[model samples]
Target: MSLASREALASARERLDALADNTAVDAAKLAEELAAVTALLDREVSLRRVLTDPAQSGEAKAELARRLLAGQVGEECVELVGGMVRSRWSRSRDLVDAIEELASGADLIAAERAGDLDDVEDEVFRFGRIVASNPELRAALADKVADRRAKAELVRELLGGRANPVTERLVLRLVTAPRGRSLDGGLNALSKLAADRRNRMVAEVTSAVPLSDQQKQRLGEALATLYGRRVHLNLDVDPEIIGGIQVRIGDEVINGTIADRLAEASRRMAG
Candidate 1:
């Protein structure tokens, strides 16, 4: 990772960081751009075909990738990718990792400020489960049915009103694709982005804030009781937690913050 090519990733990451805060960045445009990138990648297979041509040297294959990226994607894409080509990265994967990384990075940059879309997660998962559970769903997506519209319509029926526009469109694309025959892969693809989107590592913490020895001990015991397993506490800092400290375990943030207590008191008064 500390190689010269890593420097290109750093540069690309910097470019991407500037765009991350804008929630309105167009997914449709990004998807179109990514599709073009995938096409370029698919075309790169020819470079390997000539790699071992005895008359050709290693430099030739590197030059091939450089030209392709340069011509199709312009200087910025070309140079960053060209850096990788010139570097002695292994050719065994045939540059599959490089392509995948770029696409994933692009998606992350586009989705960075977009808040969580739980409907996408639930609907995509449900669609996958339905496909797996029903023979007809699998058949519709499979090559057995040549009508693309019908296959796509089935996907629409399953996902309509239940998923976001992005999920609806993307699921339609995948269902019409060959791999959609496998419910496992469809779910995996949909969930893959969600898992990637979930940037934070879940820390199931149980703590008495500004934890003293006895409170910490008792809080760990309580967390174990609630979680049904022992948890390591991050020991939050809050004076408002009158008796017990707040525990932040992943998305299920146990926010027994002083603010919550105040809100509850206000609610009772209003009633």
Candidate 2:
């Protein structure tokens, strides 16, 4: 995100946090309502463009948003969307993206309130792995021609009682309305959002075997020290790595595995 978008997101997050802090507000309903607004903005290009138009005054755009969303959504949802339009977005789509993020954040907050946030995060990661490992499943979820209702039912059947409710809802929403994102992309986004709820970065750690508890702690601490931010380890066992571990944080990879060394050596020899 650009500096402008980051500022906008931060401001929006403050509003969400305030809403979450209110004991009377229902977090789950807030999530669903925000998601509906996200869908509305996503489908209505002209409306999004108008809301994000630089030429229009922020207050004017906000009033328009409030008027459109007033009776359709809760007061909190109306205020939230109205606030979002009051900020400047770099692109029209950024507005929808921000709303989508808030929706995910709201769901995570619900899980946190239920003391199931960690479970939801792990479930999301595990579900991503399941989808990645099964080509048939991946194809089924990614099939554009398939009915979305059928796809959602398949998701419910696969995940129903097995995963946290928030996890199930997040995955179901992604599969039902991908918005041009792949299943992997959607899962990745959700995972990151889950981590962000705790103000941590996720490190995809691959090793030949599962790291011990002490080892996991040490690695997490080392990553935190290296990155200057709290790190959450998403451990993966890949025997192909031979030894050591490979850590990936976003685009940066710190490869210490024998497999990576050998691959580098092979490339150098070819060169």
Candidate 3:
């Protein structure tokens, strides 16, 4: 995103925060509505371009958004979308991306308010790992030619009662309407968004064995101290690592597994 788009998105997030702070507002419904708006804008390129057009007055674009969304969505959603159009976006697609982000953020906020955010975050990461391991399932969800309804049903069947409602909804939306994102990419994006809800960083921790609660706590604390932010662990088990753990925070990796050590030693000998 350009600076303008980033600023616009930041302002929109603040607006979402205000809405979330209101006990009367339904964050889930807000999420659904924003997703709908995002889908609409993504499909209607000309309209999005017009809404983000610099020549048009901000009020005009805002009014147009309000008029288009008035009866179809709630007042809060209409106002939110209206405010978004009233702001300058670097590109029309940036507008859609910001709204999509807001949709995910709204779902995270819903989970947070319901005290299920931690579970949702963990569920998202675990689901991504599951998809990574299951080629058939990943293909099913990633199939663009597949019927949307079928994919939606598969998502619901997999997540319905087994996961938090917010998690189910977020996954269902991404799987059903990927918007050209690969399955893993979409899932990772959702996981990151979930972490950002609390201003935390996610550390992907892979180990030969599951870490105990104390171990997880200490590792999280150490990473937090290192990164200067709260860290959430996305734990994975892989016996192939043989011992110790591998921690991935974004592009950086802290490798301590026996497999990694052996590989390095073999490379040194080969050299």
Best by lDDT: 3
Deviation in angstroms for 94 in model 3?
0.9
What tens digits encode model 2's per-residue C-alpha lDDT throughout 1-271?
A: 7788788989999999999898688889999999999999999999999999989999999999988988898999999988989998888998899999899999999999999988998899999999999999999988999999999999999999999999999999999989989999999999999999899999999999999999999999999999899998888999989999999999999999998899999999999
Measured on C-alpha atoms, candidate 2 has an lDDT of 0.93
Model 3 TM: 0.98
Lowest summed-lDDT stretch of 10 residues in model 2?
1-10
Q: Is candidate 1 or candidate 2 better by lDDT?
A: 2
Q: Candidate 3: where are CA atoms >4 Å away?
A: none
Write model 3 residue lDDT over 190-239, tens digit each, in one string.
99998889999989999999999999999999999999999999999999
Candidate 3 whole-model C-alpha lDDT, 0 to 1: 0.94
The digit string of per-residue lDDT tens for model 1 on 155-184 reads 778777766666676676565543323646
C-alpha lDDT values of all predictions:
0.53, 0.93, 0.94
> On a 0 to 1 TM-score scale, where does candidate 1 land against the true structure?
0.49
lDDT of 2 at 56: 98
